[model samples]
Target: MAEETDHESKTEAATERRVREAIEKGDIPFSREAPVFASTLGLLIALALFARGQASQLARDFAPLLDDPRGFALETGGDAMLLLSRVALAAGRFLLPILLILAVCSLTASLLQNLPRFVLDRIQPKWSRVSPMAGLSRIFGTSGQVEFLKSLVKFLSVSVVALLLLRSERTRAVNAMFVDPSQLPELILTVSIRLVSAVAIATIVIVAGDLVWARLRWQRSLRMSRQDIKDEHKQTEGDPSVKARLRSLAQDRARNRMLANVDRATVVIANPTHFAVALRYEPSENPAPLVLAKGQDLIALRIRAIAEEKGIAVIEDKPLARSLYDAVQVDQTIPAEFYRAVAQILFFLFARAR
Candidate 1:
């Protein structure tokens, strides 16, 4: 029975840890579109990088095959197949490397922007997931409204760009039909440039919309209420009362340990109302002074009582006492700026001790 209880306790602890990790992750679901977009962009970049070399190699490899059908068949299939296969393999050797590097880069880029967190609850079998009414509601949701606006903006931007590009290319577009055949390439080049520029403009608009969406989505994900955090802590760390008791016990023990050092202190500085700080200086062992104990209010009063019972000197300097209590913590030396004032107090104490 004891062994079974221990096992159950361990299982409960594991469940709580898992819940805490999920809460810290902000419960964001993975979006498939971002990864797909990243991979596509990476592939485009990879293709652009090798465009010239790959285009030239392809031309060289295919030009001879295009000229003779028998030679093409023989090179591709028959007696010359081995040599043709080796050539083809050699020509395509860099393709896999390019693809793998781009894929990894795309995955890394996507992850760096926002790590996809899987939440089973989001995709659970519910009426909402499959309902037409639910779908319509989402389509009319704030995010859905933004999506509609973005689509409208994209359409308008693309139409404007297309119209501008067409207008700019109108003269060359018309001349292409009547001009000499030698001018055909120039007209084609002009139209291609216009189309590419228009497409580039459209891409920029889409990217801007994506940036806005990413920011908004992250903001929404990071929102958490005070009660939600409290509930999450309860779920993750067990009851609030138990944790509070543990913390209180720990603090009490710490205070006792600090009071135990009261007899060892060289001096005690008091605010005479709500603050007490004790310092211990040993010239033989410590180069600088150290705080032996410090406390405020009830703890402060307790420290003062312990000091009185131990016959430790109690010095009252309102500003110096307050500053020491605020700025320097227990077991730390006072700062250099207060050295002169501290020296005066120490000198008086040493003279009185003598």
Candidate 2:
């Protein structure tokens, strides 16, 4: 009941991060029946194409030993060993193609559903994997029950197919026993082709249904709650509090650098208590005077104090101080629009210096 409630609570689709992490952990929708179906298909193909030829070849190769047993004698260990080697080589030659076909088909089936990825976490030892409760939960879980139903369906379908084929060919099967030894291979190949083809046809439906079910279950498992999305957003972007704190620290460092440069100002414009803008001018250095520093309120007071300690000139012009602080940036030339107001200030300061 609690599990169902939890499942219901997760209404949102899985975020990209969640999906990526799941894949990194080797969690993917894979149909077990697909590989089984592929192996069956491989068997059917090999039986149809290669089985008749190989069986005949093997039969011909063994004809001497089987047809006239008295002609061959294993008198010594060397003779026995040689005979065993020949048998092994012949069996391997007959079976190698079938084995290769099965392997390729199985791999292709798996790759069609999900690409391969190596994840150590998948193979790592985990207590939950071996836990009794976990094992039982898996066995009795809805997913397990669904799998059981699928397996039951596949088994019944394949069994019915086998039974029907056997019933229909019961006479032929009995008569096969009495056939010539050389003809036995062809008869066996015919029966195998029929049985494998029937089984393959019957299980195709089960495999297709299982593939869809597996994908649905995997997607359902990935569903996230609203809170989960919020938490992931914080992790991927950044926490609000931490970002604010970082912004604060950056502003403080910039202010300190500005104050340190205030000592180099030729003059400081101030509202006496609220605003300050420090300007530095030299005919050879820049086309217009550059503001060395500007600030309001507490920062303005700090800039003024720094100027006073360095013995730099402080001019009180409440209106001009406000405008300069609004429009000017430290280390940047004052705007051309402010040229008249600022040139007048420099003229008065230069006259006072003389």
Candidate 3:
């Protein structure tokens, strides 16, 4: 009841992240009926291809014993052991091919549905696996009820197929009873193959339906509540407060780095106290003057103070300072349009030094 209530609360379809996580955790939709259907089909194929030859070989091996049971003596332990080994070998030959076919078909069926992955969580022991309540809930749950209904339908359908095949072959079956015992294996193989082929055809519809059902059930199980989506978003994108703090910290670090580059400036263009643009120029190193730092107001005053302390030239040019501060970025070249204005400042400072 609690589980059902929880399931009902998940009204929204799961997000891509939710689906991906579910798959990583080894939660995937798999239809048990797919493998059953494949094995049943494999059984039919085995009966058609191999059963006839094996059964004939088996019958031939056992014919002498069946024809004259009293003539073959089992008087000693050695005689009994010899007979037993022969019987075992003949039985193995008849059954081994069919068993192999079933095994291959079952494996292929499973692989077609889901890729193989080793998930430790699936193998780990859990309390729910041993709990009586859990076991009972699983046995009587929606999935269990559906499985029961499907199995009942499959059994009835297979039975009907067998009955119909038997009805059609009644004459041949009766005639085989009076025919040579050696020919009985062939007669039985024909009927078995026909019955399995009919049943296999019937199972095709059931398997296709079950595959669709399993996928829908799995998707429904992965559905999320509105709260669940919000929580998942937070976990994926992180807390808003924390993101803001991080952005602030990054800005502070960049500002400090820009301020530290003030001492390397060849010229500091200042709009008195309103703006400052510190530039470094070397014709050999770069084609244009690089803006080392730019700031406004208090930061402008700080840049001017740092320029005085480092003995770098500071020229008050309101138009150039404001334009460079707006147009240039730290650690980037000034535009060609500002080249003449900045070059005039550089020439004046160099001439004074000379």
Candidate 4:
């Protein structure tokens, strides 16, 4: 029990990936009451529109048997079968529209709750589902208790609604009791319509409430653990620490390569201590001076030390060194905006060499 509690505590709000995976597995929030409500409402509407017509058609179909029972007798068995088939076909035709309405309502309710998606996993057999212990636990669990309470509430509420509706029409019922038997059917139909309509309306309200509650419960169930969220992030964006380490290694390799290129540069310009930029110029091979390497602070100190060791000219030009380091990249030709400044520096160096 303590382990179970700890596991439950680890889970928090579900991540998008978790929710999407659950959807793919056919795990979705749904309220069974939604379809029942839709079907009941549709049935009530269908009855209101076609009940009288259906009753008249039924009376017509059965009237022959009632008026002249001897006429149904036939010499051949096939004739009797044909007569029965015709009656059955007529009944089916009459009820087809109502059945269609109920079917459409059920489908619409299902679609609204969770849009259609084909997932064969939902239909696949699972041994755990068939386990007797699991079945018993499900029947005696928290969900079962909630279902039982809901059933009891529905029964009591419908009973109260029915009693109220019947009491309201008691006077008419009493009057109808004394009327001709033929009038009794009409009176009963009227009372039934009122009772059913009230019940459907009440059920719809209950179903709406249940749908909200069910959705909240489903969301809670999908909550994920902190570790699960981190794992998903690593899968999608990679582990942050690993990425940082790789970046540091890449920077080190680039810096080593840059230091090696300092030997090929014609001059190393420095801000004395804070900045360093090594420039290479070959008038025959290139039109403008190229930045061979650049670095700042500690790296700048290392660049100056390497230049001194290699016997390369190290010029301390604060503004030029700072501008080169900020604006130019290694292996890139100096920009046109810095052309005059770079040209003067190169010319001065050539004169000094001559």
Candidate 5:
């Protein structure tokens, strides 16, 4: 039960690296509704722009065939084949713009939701996808159920909207029936465009809502377990114990270097056991005394021992040692606040040497 609880608890949000890895694996947020919405919009626009022209062209092209089929020299096989070819060419040219519009709409819709990316892994076939159990699970899964429900709702809603719009346009449609025969096509085209536009706008609202929900669900699905977070941190930043060992090794090398410089120090001021600061001054080259090294506790003992071994003076002035250790750093000149005390010590050492 304890193990189960631990496994169930995925409270941590996924890291950026995790999300990026998922994208590389082609596991990304997407909404099927967006493409549907885009295609509908594209179709509506294409129809609005080209419908009347195409209708007129179709009427003109086929008018002769419809009015007087016997006028064609169809008794010859060559003439019949030529007529069929011309019809095919005309139909292809007429539909090409709408097809192009739909393709562009689908591509643009996908690009807006997710930046273009190609992952070979997504195209590779997986055994799980072909498994009977997997298929059954997908059909019964929470996501599948939700998708089905959403489709049903969309179909019902669109149908109701379309019906209501058609009812509203009933009077105009009836009046168009009595209009001049040539004008009837234009009237029907106008009403059809308006109805499609209304339906497309309504579908856009549904698609927008689905997109927001899908994104939230995608993020939630990517949430990390506590152990997963820990593993990623280790992978990115290295193990804590290993890092601590490296830090300790670096500190030891720096301390050895600092102790070696203590041999050049003119004087060492000590807090006896807790702190030590070593000072060096060159009258011709240095404007003020410089701290050669400063340390506390174990490091302080090592600094004092090095000073004694090098025959450098070691003085126990608690207040001055603490002040210098606090205010000065290794290889830096003592600050003005500590100048008087440090200068007196340097002067006394010089006098003794003389």
Candidate 6:
């Protein structure tokens, strides 16, 4: 039963369950990309933009270097070793900010998702890792199909944006060659902004779609089978056989206890077919006589067994036994109306004893 119950629990725990739980709790993320991915993407974009800005500044600053012989000499390098060092230092300085930003953003993303949970399952080796056949299968799997579609869409989207930008600025770009250089920066910024915005919007939409897909999958995984619910109910309520055994044990214990006290009972009254009750009197203390034991069917047989074992007289009083069983509980005094009827039975018992 335990094993069956465990299997049922496992079956009910599908990926969809997690998605449903997340949705119910409002714990689902806005996009499929974890904080780390979002931060990394943001950092990469920021860095790229910074790099472009820095390159522009460098071009504007060093624009006059080409006109001056000494400045040109300094830019080109007089000392071979020093020139290489300078160029390396300049490259590092230009790129370092973006690299640092990306690293920080990546860390921030990881932090948002709760850093370094370090689940061993993620690091474990599997047949898929070593199997070329499996790798090929996965590549042609549903996941691969989705990836292929995504790539195709991305390529088309980027191409469309690129064409639009080039088409819109074609005349200005050609005309800017002889025009004031100020117009050139404005044009470049406008084109870059439009392209970046389009790409960013596309990326957001794709990521959002992926998140939705994941949520759907999670919900599907959580679905419970009919068998699973039934098994869980059995596990929680206990097995039918065990419950029956427990009930039998309880009856046996009660019978034993009642039989042990039967020798002290004053009278055993019976409905003959259905109910039986035993009553005892302690006139020295109790205000009224109390019922010693009561039961129906097999329990009535058990009451008779105890009474016969103890040599207590069992009277086949059908009406009195049934009334007492219905109106009174074990260890309680009989009601007033039943008292007069019971007195007559006690008088008869005493007359027989004499």
Q: Which residue runs of candidate 6 sit more than 4 Å off their true CA positions?
A: 1-118, 171-190, 221-225, 228-264, 280-292, 315-320, 323-354
lDDT of each: 0.70, 0.91, 0.92, 0.85, 0.86, 0.70
Model 2 clashing residue pairs (backbone): none
Better of 3 and 6 by TM-score: 3
lDDT of 4 by residue, 1-354 (tens): 985776587667898888899999898999988898888877887778876677567667766766677887677999889788978977886678889989999889989999988999998999779999888877888777877877888888899999999999999988987876555545776787888899987777679888987888788778877887889999999999999999999999999999999998888999989999988899987898888889999999999999999988899989988988889999998899888987887789889989
The superposed Cα distance between candidate 3 and the true structure at residue 195, in angstroms, equals: 0.6
For lDDT, candidate 2 versus 5, the one ahead is: 2
> Could you give candidate 2's per-residue lDDT for residues 159-217 as a string of tens digits?
99999999999999899888888887788889889999999999999888999998998
Error of 1 at 61 (Å): 12
Cα error, candidate 1, residue 45 (Å): 7.0
Select the stronger candidate by TM-score from 4 and 5.
Answer: 4
Candidate closer to the true structure by TM-score (higher is better), 1 or 2: 2
lDDT of 4: 0.85
TM-score of each: 0.42, 0.81, 0.84, 0.86, 0.81, 0.65
Count residue pairs with overlapping backbones in model 1.
0
Ranking by lDDT: 3, 2, 5, 4, 1, 6
Report clashes for each candidate as comma-separated counts: 0, 0, 0, 0, 0, 11
For candidate 1, the 10 contiguous residues with the lowest summed lDDT are 7-16
User: Once model 1 is optimally superposed onto the true structure by TM-score, how far is the C-alpha of residue 211 displaced, in angstroms?
Assistant: 1.6
Find the number of clashing residue pairs for candidate 6.
11
Candidate 3 matches the true fold with a TM-score of 0.84
